[model samples]
Target: MTTMTTDARFREFKMPDVGEGLTEAEILKWYVQPGDTVTDGQVVCEVETAKAAVELPIPYDGVVHELRFPEGTTVDVGQVIISVDVAPGSAPAEAPAEAAAPAAAPAAPAEETAAEPEGRQPVLVGYGVSQSSTKRRARKEAPGVPAQESGAPAGTYYASPAAAAVQAELNGQAPAEPEAPSARPLAKPPVRKLAKDLGVDLATVTPSGPDGIITREDVHAAVAPAPAAAPVSRETTPAAQAPVQAAPVAAGARETRIPVKGVRKATAAAMVGSAFTAPHVTEFVTVDVTRTMKLVEELKSGKDMQGLRVNPLLLIAKALLVAIKRNPDVNAAWDEAAQEIVLKHYVNLGIAAATPRGLIVPNIKDAHDKTLPELASALGELVSTAREGKTTPAAMQGGTVTITNVGVFGVDTGTPILNPGESAILAVGAIKLQPWVHKGKVKPRQVMTLALSFDHRLVDGELGSKVLADIAAVLEQPKRLITWA
Candidate 1:
């Protein structure tokens, strides 16, 4: 039995689980290709997981030997993706005994080795040997039958139906016919979902991906409307009777399709789960924020708030924090599995920021302990990081309550959805100047609308109303912030 062995100078790098328990990541781009030299801690590629986009760095120095997969391919964790030659200038080093043992040892039964090999090492980050025996198996020839149905293993990747048919004829057998209707097509889950959404049949679409797998492009091509046939008129004149052909439709002129993955996909799933799993109740209140608006301008010119992001959001976030302090029950989460309500003592304030990738809520850790200036600084950093798309997954976890500034977009107000695991979300509308009745007289004053959405299971109507009222009260009279604290 022949076994494959690699030179000791060659080292393989496997795709790592970047986030906690993330099983796969899509290779977005590669910075270096084969034959390029690399050093330790150099970013070799960027991958997008369900959480966010992240760059991966190589651990050791070497000359690139090979790249197993191309860009845009989704790779599972613990799969060998790239190899490098560590000792480039030196002669080939001696292969380790264990690396060469498969070739020297007696051949074991096929069932024994296929099921599970003895002494296999556990694959972990930055450690473990690449398994050499897991290469693709050879295809077996069968007369007048497709390779997949002729004892090939389930989920085996095939070249193409045409290639299989040609090979069957060369082997002195009749060419294989088209795959049966009952045969399942090979496509990724996301591609299948896309096809289903567009009402396209995957079986009829041609396969352009490697190993006879259908791709998003192939499905789109199958569903794209054909140019309209020429219209013929029944008339006495010859010119009217003749048919006239229409010009072919240009690609992407009528519609465009975008494949959803990574952050956008995760956000959609989370919003659906949060909306369906928890019973949501929304409360709205319109308040005069003339004092809060004036306070924001004053703080912008004040010495204490200088060089910080001083705006209405700063005070609005502060108001919510103080409100949560008063109504501590609002700062809690429902433990579905435990069937209990876990009340939190500290606040991790979530700020819902809209980014190009999607909407992400990155919260300030332990926001209750922060002073006014410190809170302003944290808000500035969080907004900047999210807009730059550099927010990490850890920055988004453990948020007890959230605030979304829909006011920035000029919207009047909206009933915002709760972020998963959070108890409530506060929406702030545009602060517009309007005529209002104040001091028994009508006058122009700055007014804003606020909407609060909460999970009804943990927060009763009385508790939710109290939290929202406290926020509105603080915004209307700015001095309440100092007194309430």
Candidate 2:
């Protein structure tokens, strides 16, 4: 048998759907650029989707040949963004110039030479090279002046078409023929839009991109020029000038507008959907959590929970889990398509965390099987990761129940909206000292309010009340966690 070697070819990497059914993602940053050698499973770029920031890893080892899109560009799913040469030693594919050179005469015009097709190979999955001929839009040139000068000044001269035509008529010369459109500076659609919006001419802006392409930074720099001193005016003297009045400020002048793109957009859409689709019934209960607070202090000093997050929220989470075990029917979802109730045997408990980006719920998988210490550790890690904005999309999916602690913000209580696809959500309020009737007498006790919101379709008033009552009962009597759980 004879062994044969294949030629080296370029491989294109497309932007993948990072999140569940995500259609697009913004390129946050690129770790590797062109000519950078990358290995398999090495992260090359970071993209921000509607859910979270995701780091994309290259699938194979190769030398990067081209980067199709720059940073901050929003690319659609399955669009090719990067190309790499897998085999560096092999000869590259034949250039189109060599094939077209013989067909055209040796003295062909520069326009014909510039119009040759770029025969690039299709290397991305589900994408192929377009077979149609590439045509360039004709750029309307000034009628009088030529595109280039034989000997001009050091700096390149650029003028508007109207100005050039006016100057040519004054010089008493006929307008020169237009040049090829390919001679114009190269730029992406977004960059051209930015230049137009900033009132900056692309012809006067020097390009800093690869292959003489114009970039956003180049356009911005052209718009912001160095300050020059204004000439002193002798016509209007300071003594003869009249007093000027200050104009009134408009409304919302100091307000800043932030674009809704990533996690914030997803959160807004989910809240609107949940509020309209589900019949939300919220019930409030003011409970005495003096025992629960004392238990939190004891656990903080315990050897098992020393380094973990030991707080009222930790005990409250355990209490809710215990309550779920008592009332398993509450841990379910209503399937509209199937017209049935989907009850989950396991619990993926979600904790609503407020980060700099927005509110995100990262859940602890299999919370029903973990002990108190394990639960505390998981909560600690979840809070830490959420604060750093490193929570993955998988951590935010498939949650059966969620807990939003408004107490941290000093809020008394709130009717929290249910997370999408979840059956119930619990809100914990600020714990304060208040006089309550205990043992037939009014005494000072640590009291806190709990709000439970549920879908009325799946959980009736009785079942929802039972779950909330069970949670309050466990918090009031801390020993029930051991007996009920």
Candidate 3:
């Protein structure tokens, strides 16, 4: 048998373009640190692009050698973020004579010694290492520095090396004391927010998740056994008596400033561009959806539709698909550069979902080909994935039409802006009981309003009106779905 020897080959994993043509992503958190052994296909870090949060998996097995950037740093595509030593037992490559002569060049700059590695290595599909001149800029402050001295703004936290050293010196002269844990408990942002809302201390609760990460269940359990305490009166408190002076006001007490980034930023830019570029015209129609409501109830208890989400939105989506089929001209996009109107044969239906990060419109591919049950299942999975913040960037790309259900929020109707590339978007308002003139009689009926917004360049007034009227007709009479489709 041949013996194997350690080979000192280090591979660098670069930040990839997680979304279609995306240029950058902010490093949210790191799952592996230096000296940690990682396997192939194991997620090492999570990054947030303009579209969604994506977990990147390492393609090769090795020990992590270094993390090039800290958390919350935005890195560009093709820039190396982590280096791994594939062969741990082998010796590292020797540096050049000029680089190694520390005594000879005592005044050499620190940055000159920290040059990036030469050459490229393949890491993932559609992404290979390249010798791009792109580099991460120097942080305003170095790691482990006091926030004020390091030039960090208020409301930000940073570790101070000088403070730690001073504390260590004092501890040597004083009596022995027990050391406290340095790292905080592991928990996601959502879980931490939940714990704060419930007044549950994460450190006191027991973590049952993998790697000691505190989960939502742990926070709920901690809150369940606590006894309700009586409120304290300020007049009877000793601290309240001593502090008669006015308290200092924080800078953000009156107004909060949220950074514009990720999905929210992209959405804002797209809305501004679409509103000004595309001459939009909105048409509204009020229709009685009592029969559609009855069909929704019927589908909920059906054998095939059981365990799936069967709501008015499902039928409303089907109705829009049928309307598009009837008026095929409404399902088209405008190409400004080519000065052409491109009509699509397939329908990629987009559903606007409000996530914690912001609004994201992830679509279903080939939605027109799916049956009612299939559409219901796909809608269920899409909403669930969007809520969990796991919707991929690919899922949100390439759409022909969209639907936004403002009805869920008890609104009558809205003129929604079209998605950047798509031609039309439909807004469905709340279904309410109202007096209607049905069959020459004033009776209470379930009525809803529909608004269709389209790019006037390709879809004229007649086409937009037809699409909206067809959807209203389908909802008014549910049987039209079979005949029209």
Candidate 4:
């Protein structure tokens, strides 16, 4: 055969239409710089959508060719975010060639265009949803772009604060911890919430974490825990308590005040909106989940799932899915305009994730269809991404039902508010050893509380009660899943 040229077709990474017709998103930061060797599935940048910031993992692995937009620049969805040049003779991501499997495959290029309708608004009072991809986004490419020049610092393109610290730690050249002067301190969001709840001024308390950070432990140590017998008060304000801050170095008087902005400010707005507009009706049921806990332990020790956090939370998520299948109404939404119920065939499961920024509910798409292992992995990724402040707005929408694991914080039970669109939210409370009745005798058993809050307008007391009961019953006897499943 005569000479044949095999020039590789370059692929570009387009900004995916994350869900709602989010016209544009700001490039918060880029994780990789030009010329860095990236593999498929590696996170390259963190983009802030309309709702929250999310880490955009690279779908393809190759040398990054170009960055089209600068940090803090707002880029429309379905635009070219980055590009990777596949070397000639290299196999592409998911390429069907047998020879390409021998070496590192080219990066998995994301779908170039999102075929969403140009401009669609959300049915509710908020944003719209995207139904198509943009074709023009796929062709633009930057040739001879400096992908990565030899051992560049982490996040060279974005230059985020956290990336710097990670670079130091990774290279075994971490700088010496600074001599923390300033006897004063700064409080985090949750600590600030604790201060507001207990009427404690945060300015006075000395911060113990890095950069004089106030922690939840600091707040708890400063005040007493809520009394177990007294019910959790649902009042807007806890009380007018003083924020504790620095005591004087010399014998002196002291006073301080912290503005309730940032987390506290945003949280107040969300809680009020969810609580009032949703008309929450909380119902509780106590169940003995001893078998559920046992099954969890078995799964944890199982050979296949040796490394996952297979805890009670995993089982609770499954129980909620079962309930949704049993009582389909629990997974439905209310259409106020037409005055009708919109029953959904799929479940975009929302797990209320509390983060430093605020509360974000990064949901699972078609959650009802996922297997237990898949659900576990999805939950794991969602929680990890949320805590890192990388959950995207698109991942947080079209949720038909929700599950809030309050027990993760040792909370027994509380009525959760309905997410703006969905009608019902299930709160899986802490599971603890408690005394219970079995075979007409009292015994100590593993117990948990199932709290479900529903919109009274659509979901009546009976339907709500049945859904909650169904989840509780599944947990009470784990074997039922084998039959019901």
Candidate 5:
């Protein structure tokens, strides 16, 4: 007979890149109190990175052993979130260990009862992928009932809540029956906002991979679309067609409250710090780049550029890279503590985009080294990922510089804010066919405005102007970009 050794096993659930190829995530909230029994696939916590808010599930059926973080701490990817001691069955109908504790120590003083094992190891933040043994629960349903496929689902199920919610969006689902448990999520403030923006209904989305917890994906699947509502509502009544609806402000109601979460919250804090400390000095210059528009059209048709989006933004990104190469100082930052200008040898170029999750800045690492095609692919991927509200914290972090495409909104220009810890943010305004003096003669041509918001402490008016001029010059004459490179 072979001798067997007894050992405590562990499951380290890493914070996964939930969406937009994230690198890091922030702990938004913890739902499962430590020492509470958690079901396999139960939602133990909620997390928000740059893209979206997700409810992370407990992957094992066990006793809640520990919680590693507080409600609002930021954590890196692959960090442990929670720990489970795993009882043979669901957290023994009652905490047998606690109840049996007094008997084991009848001689001990009652004061020691205060120690009641409250400070056990905690689950980690960012996501509830923690110390566990990934063992599954055995199903409880008759084989004929399809709902019982995964042991006992963390909670009861009815006509899939997500399906019901999406059907509600279609303007004609029977109201939820009084007997049914609400499909609403138990998410915190940040998660609620994320769901709202994605058009996802929290109530119906099924939770998998966690304690019967609904995830952002569950919401997505719920809103996946029954069909588009008509552009004009045919069911409008005379009261509904009033010039404006009154804002309801009844007792026990909330109004005009903004949540500090995800990209919006991060951006707010960063912008505030940058604004107060950096001594911002914004200057603007309008150039008639008729030739730049011509080149944009030319490149769109080029065989070499095949399947690429050869637009003003592409040219602007390329131009910024070129300018940074020429003027390294403008690409650098002010390190007040070191009292030195930190000139980055590499450029992790950030692109500030407006997504369903609010405004996000997802950057391309080593963008200065990427080719045109590579840059194109990166841009496409970033936009698509942001649209899905899946950008991770990793992608949003470590950005040396950034650019914002305000032009897509048909705006002429405005002063942009610098991302915290970074030296500059470039705002690309709309290109319009405005009549202007070409060589001193009024004529119609495509023109755009470029707003470069840089850290005045690092980049002075001279450096900022030169950088803007370089980018504008490239847009004005594409040939200058080749030679400037």
Candidate 6:
């Protein structure tokens, strides 16, 4: 039988590591599906790693042939999630006998080329695979098994268990029956991990994703206990002394359990690590910020600060920067591995922002070198990007010091925890009009509290005290920013 070969027309696209050595990402959305024409550099889907949300662009132009995984599925790097037909409209002389096999297969190889030319497949974001590591040896087919009925395609490395079962059926051998469903529950790796962590059985959970796939929400809902029954109202009781029966409570009405993953998961892990590993010491001081508030209003109308976000946080960030300048020793990290205290010359000023994802601290690269207006502009961009959930992993790294404005939530001063690897964190409380002794007379003044938390291993009480005092001084007398800086 003559079989036309059109496999060379198809090309597979593997999931690329979007960030620094990330292993996997959850498919947030898909922009294209099978038969959709896509061009070079066209975004195919959005994926979320532990760090951030990233959109992936297709490298070459083609008509999409298959989507291996659906949305909300977390796929590992180097796994083929998509396949495209580079030559979609090519005519074939004869169709192969095993044409129905590829349709039923979940992971069908696109090509059967023996050798991989150097850089034939381009990896996204400059993370390329080695030329020698790109190709795999073909698996030997079992006796009496057709070429397409083999466990895997020629030169293909990976084959799932489901693919193995398909091979058995193609060979006319029925394998042993399964205890649960005929096929295993459809779920990604991370969702499986979450179910395992929560001690939930995937087979017992009702799947809500497309094609009967289990989602993260489904896993969470599986373990959610039914709400407690409400007490019977006394006025509606048939008899005052009769036994009371509880009213039925609706599901998920009283509380909600949000599964911690992605950015929130990373943040929670980092916070727990920082709290236990580092020896923290927090110092508090209430200061009169009447001068700083006035300065903020003045900078708003100034030509230098035009079109900038000038608020108490702006002046407060500047104040903290000036304080760091006064005490450079406070800008250091404790290297436990080397048993050394590494002091930083440049300061990446971190601003803690709360988003729908979670709290993220994105920092300005070098706040010490920037002018007031430049600092204001950088701060504006940082806050805006963080609020929109576009803060990249690189933006949250290498921070020397941080400022968390709890005042925005109308909170008094809090004992802030030190961000991992950073020396200190400053917490700013709400600025309220309070009666205070100003110029030896009682008057209503703009007052706020400042709390400084630092790693005692690198910053002693004396150094931490000086840094806190300098910040307080800068806020009390705004002119001290120039003198201290």
Q: Is candidate 3 or candidate 6 better by lDDT?
A: 3
Worst 10 residues of 4 by lDDT: 233-242
lDDT of each: 0.71, 0.70, 0.70, 0.61, 0.60, 0.69
Candidate whose lDDT is highest: 1
Q: Please count the clashing residue pairs in each candidate, in the order shown.
A: 0, 4, 0, 35, 32, 0
Q: What is the lDDT of candidate 3?
A: 0.70
lDDT of 2 at 451: 100
How does model 2 fare in lDDT? 0.70
Q: Residues 1-485, candidate 1, lDDT per residue (tens digit)?
A: 21223554456677766655577888989999989988766888888878766677775666888888899988987677777765455444244423433354565456533632454333323333223333223232233433332222211112134334544465667876746423556654445645775678888998997556676568758875322111221111111111233446677688545677878799999999999999999999999999999999999899977667678888999999999989999999999999999999889899887765667787876789888887887777676666555666656777899998888767889999999999999999998999999999999999999999999999999999999999999999989899998
Q: Write the per-residue lDDT of candidate 6 for residues 7-47, one digit (tens) a residue.
A: 53355667876655578888889999889998756889888
Q: Write the per-residue lDDT of candidate 3 for residues 78-177, one digit (tens) a residue.
A: 7778766544544343443243333533554555334545643222321233223222221222122211121111111112232233233344533223
Q: List runs of model 3 lying over 4 Å from the truth.
A: 1-8, 95-127, 130-252
Give the runs in model 4 whose Cα sits over 4 Å from its true position.
1-50, 55-271
How accurate locally is residue 178 in candidate 5, as Cα lDDT from 0 to 100? 27
Tell me how far the alpha carbon of residue 126 in candidate 2 is from the true structure, in angstroms, after superposition: 16
Q: RMSD in angstroms, candidate 4?
A: 20.2
Model 3, residue 394: what's the lDDT?
63
Model 6 off-target regions past 4 Å? 1-6, 92-123, 126-128, 135-255
Off by over 4 Å in 5: 1-46, 49-255
Candidate 2 lDDT trough over 10 residues, lowest sum? 150-159
RMSD of each: 20.5, 21.1, 17.6, 20.2, 15.4, 18.1
Cα lDDT tens digits, model 5, 226-340, are: 2221122122111111122245567987665545566666567777888998877777778777887788788778776666555667778988999999889887878889999
Better of 2 and 4 by lDDT: 2
How many times do residue backbones clash in model 5? 32
lDDT by residue for model 2 over 1-485, one digit each (tens)? 21222212355667765555577888888999888987756788888878777777775556777788888888887677777655443334343223322333355445533432553322211222221222222222223333332111111111123223333544676755433323455554335545764577899989897556676668767875312111221222111122223345678687555678888899999999999999999999999999999998888798866556577888999999999999999999999999999999889899987765677888876788778887776776666656555677766888999999888767899999999999999999999999999999999999999999999999999999999999999999999998887
